[model samples]
Target: MSNDTFTSWENLVKKQLKTDDINAVLRKENLEGIDVKPFYTDVQQPLVNLPKIEESTHLVAKYHESLEEDVFAFLLNENVENLEQKTIFVNNVDLAGHISPKEEVQYFSLIDVFDEKNATVNDQLVKELLAKQFKRNICIDIALHQNSGASISQQLGIALAKAKELTEIYGTEILEKLIFKLAVGGNYFFEMAKIRAFKILFNQLSKEFNLNLTPYIFAETSLRNKSVSDSENNLIRSTLELAAAMIGGADAVYSNNYQIGNSTDNSEEISFKQQIVLAYESIINVFEDASNGSYYVEDITKQIAEKSWTYFVETEENGGYLELLKQGNIQKDIFDHAIEEQKWVEEGKIKLIGVNLYPKLEVKKSVEELYNNTEIKPVRWAEMFE
Candidate 1:
């Protein structure tokens, strides 16, 4: 192990370690087709083509009716540079009232904020919404489809369709107004790669459209991982997810109550406070582009981007976004991915802390009580075990 004996890590391995020892370890591959090695000794140069994720990450808080004043206080006290607000409205009236000519909120749903069936904007309100320069341009919430059922790659492909269409119709100007909100799950590396993959794919599509625009992005904790039984554990999930959002280079990340159908002030407050801790107390923000040079992460980002591009092209070839959805191609793929994830939970391969791995010895709520009380969607992952 002399310093002079080390030329490369591989050379050191060969000289100091026996072949039998190295050969004994097994490699695992993820759904992204990335092979996980026990140890990575052969490091590659940073991927020059990829982008570095710097944290201009804003801390986002959910606007709650029960804690409206408190939530507002959180926002008013929060540094403008580090905070943004997400107004979760059940109807258009709410959205219309909440929207203003000027506000510091980073993102919210205007497309379908009123109702699920009629997601389009009305004629009269268009004038008001268009009157002001929003914090960003059109909002494409990939998290909505993701929380509904889309897989990592599916989320990317779905988002690409929206980006391509918007950039084509609106041109590069839309880029300045573009904002993508993604749902980050618990798979640390995969989630980080997910954001990177979408950025790369969108960047390429922008080039094809002859437009130069960098995506403004952020993520919310995945509803898929939230458990009603173990409410405290959901805080842990939020913490990890927020970390993933930071590592993935989100411009800002927000937290929401994971009590699922039941939005308690307790859960909401705990989740909201986690953001304050992450940005103010934790040094995770100190390293921007931390995963930029990793062999596995860079490789996975490229792979996910490639696969996502294939889906995007195929969807366009078949006739574009809405057409694919009409043909059930979009729904079918998302459903299939959701089923696969559900299978993992059912089989105990994916563990939900209070639901599966550990025995609660009793039910937290009746089966019906657990179903969504809020219009915000609940995921199939936590429900599978129940």
Candidate 2:
């Protein structure tokens, strides 16, 4: 439709609708506390300019000159011999500590295992794998549960610090060649902003370390907001959440399908296909960085970057990300945020669809059952580490 035609239609709708009453609908708040406005005009826009399409050189500079030797150099130069030639073992910690040869797994995730005792082991395993493996990616969740109110700054700092340490231990050149995956949460705009900001931050860090590699982002739907009572609705929520991830330029995304509150079969084909359909059927990737030019998105991206930068500087002042984490400062912040969130739910300030506001009927799947049934295991070193 032409701009004038769209504007006329909007005007007609505005005239027919009671402008005053429109506030009631627009002012409605979502679970995330994002306020909706009855109307938006260019006049109410923030004075922020759209984020500049960062120079392509900024990205090109992150990779080694050798990796850019050909059109498919990145893929061809990735050491696949290391991945296929390695033998991995799986040690079942939950069971009688039985060890089995590691079979190739389709997906992997890295989470809370950053103690001094384990850090060395983790680093060794990562180094070994990178030397041998070709097509594998490392999933790292340094930001998970670190703080409240979307601490992207802290997350980025922690991630970069870890990456730095890894590079020092296992040649910066190889570390640059590896992909680092991250976990993303439910704060739609904030999460999207975090990923975009991270790309810039990672590029900056790579330059400082003289490591050339573009950071790869893999986003998963957050587990924190999944509801057990009305679990099906979680699918709809994830659809929107994943859309934000795609718009933010995530290379890969996984939408959680199991009932957050109850345990179901892990092999849910339908849930996996949701992402497939989105990528292939919907063809969302056709328009690269679709949100790049949006006024609101650009504004939010800058806000996220500024907020994250402040947090990162604070982390440095506190002797860096790992130092604060070891002191439990990170945990304290997350606990505080959780407490505030719980209070908001109790006070009816945040209306979770099936939990806080419109509760479900006598549901078969309860939240407790979901947590109890799913045995979440950390990514095993033997599985991916050579």
Candidate 3:
């Protein structure tokens, strides 16, 4: 709606409440410290001119070592037609040998490194992969930051900084082969906006280098909020995350096998079906820009982009992403945020369905266990109470 209608509605609400300060009554703060208003008006000008997503998001399946038959059987049972359209996460190059070279499917590697030695090794490997003309081979994975409990702005900032560091070493040619692997957490709208915001910021950053680049984003469900004791709730959480990724315009997405806490049989099938339901049944793949022109989404996307760009600039001033990793600052920031969030869960401020409320009978672990390691660690928020 227009600003005039919004202003009229605001006046009526204020008169009913008998308070001039309408913002204080309706605004809420999120984890990123951004104020979310109860209602937002249509913006005259959008923050970013979002590009059209040319294809439906690819559903990525993780390939387990020595389970090639099982993976193929699941895919075949699902009647997955075009193998070339799907992506597979393979740790070793040889693991991808089952598919013909003509299939032209993409491969994602876990190659997550935080230190110099591993970074160098990964860099060399990426260069080798690119030399072989592997499509979308180099991964700029920042999913760990989210899974480890970073704010949205922090994750995007670090991602951009990492991309900058890589582009400098590999040259602008690497941009064509770059694929970002991000973790989508339970904060539905913010997680959605995070993807949109990254595209805006990354495009702007690319322009600064006299190049026009649009990023290829691959989103996966996070393990942070999943509860082992209440594993059923994980399916609900992952569904929301997957929906957010589809709406947020991720080029590809993956849902973790939530059956880890239950029966291992048919776990891959279950996760694969979850994605299938969303893509076919719900038809979320039909839209090119599902969140385009949404008042709340547009506003939050701008806020996230602005804050993330500030963080990126600050990181550059402090000698970039690797320097902070060397100084342990990156890990410290994420850990602090994680501790605060976990405390909220424990204090019953943040209600995780089966975690803090209606919890299963279980022994509690010491909170100190989380503090023992200061490095970037992956943790489930419900683990402390489970």
Candidate 4:
């Protein structure tokens, strides 16, 4: 049977099996799960509109215009002055990488030091670029390095330290207006809670320095959890991640084109359409704080804040964040956590639809092979550091 036919059959079966005694059945099964009631009583209805948290005001401009000549020219003319108004977090630095150098200069520039030889070249590039124009914000993704080998604390420390260094170099006056783009992974609840915690931490940090800047968050579905085999399942994976981002109050989210993992045009169209559907068709934007009063979400937010704050304190105690990074403590922490998470996935404690569970028909694609075929280079922060 076709997938759609199977889905329909499953739905019909589920309807027939529906019962007002679902909670009782779950109790017998010791499931401790959410129960469905046959009907809602008027007394149980909500009385007031819940307080709303402001949504992040970030925008992700992944695809600007088509490659067709006439269309590109028209779009260019219309966007020439306002190009910097949109900035998308990029995954690779290859020739075919989403953002082109020409487009980078035209829309947004780097927010790091530009002096190639300076240890702080990344910071300098950002500062220099910000100085030239003040139209829209630019991204300096130091966090990408943390994905493969660095610790969360180290990533946080580096990002925080870099922002501080830039503020000092550029002066807080101009720094107040710049946006810092953070790349998050597919840790689901943890990722969502992390963003919320960062907001609080950033505000506290700003208060200490008497700087009044609110961060603009741009999140992208992680590439780390994606697998080359069963590439089609990436759609469901990214969809969940994107939903978490939106619920966590990301100003903007960019769903990775699935084929991106293999450097092919494979599922780019579908992935992009997924995001568009969520925004326009799905109407997810209709309500703010969609997860606001949820018992689980609220509890997780508190837990994450407490843990992250404890880590932040430890960083402060260890001669501050940057000092800890220089000693590689940050990297070690991240590595350890990654190892634990990998184990969880292996043991079925953490489920990855395609990788750990619901295994797919085998089809392999190597990063090296994909890179070679597409002539794309992954972004490497180590090179920038060196």
CA-lDDT, candidates in order: 0.63, 0.48, 0.74, 0.48
Model 1 scores what on Cα lDDT?
0.63
For candidate 2, lDDT tens digit of each residue in 1-386? 56897678666766787563546544655333333344444333343222222211011111123323321211111222323222221111121122121355121223222453223335545543444333433445543443232345556666666666555556566444444445566567667766777776677677877754467665666655555556676777666667666767766555556464454444244455455566566666344465665555555566655655566667667766566656756555544444455455445565456665565223333323222111222211011111
How far off is residue 116 in model 3, in Å? Answer: 7.6
Model 1 agreement with the true structure over 1-386: per-residue lDDT tens digits: 34454446555575566554543444553445555665654456555544433335666665445555444322222113323344232124344444452365533333421122233324344334444455543566778777865668778887888666655554656565656778898888889888877777777877876776667676778887887677778888889898887777776677767676688777677788787788678756455565787777887787788888888888888877666655556666765566666656666677777877786323333333433322224464676555
lDDT of 4 by residue, 75-171 (tens): 1212233334243233222311233334444233223332212233355445444544433334545435334534344444455555565555567
Over 4 Å off in model 3, which ranges?
1-22, 52-54, 63-89, 93-100, 103-110, 113-121, 261-263, 360-363
TM-score for each of the candidates: 0.77, 0.63, 0.85, 0.64
Q: Which candidate is the best by TM-score?
A: 3
Count of residue pairs whose backbone atoms collide, per candidate: 5, 13, 0, 15
Q: Model 1 clash pairs? A: 57-251, 58-252, 91-114, 92-114, 137-177
Model 4 / residue 233 / CA error / Å:
1.6
lDDT (Cα, 0-100) at 347 in candidate 1: 61
| Per-model root-mean-square deviation over C-alphas | 6.2, 10.5, 4.3, 10.6
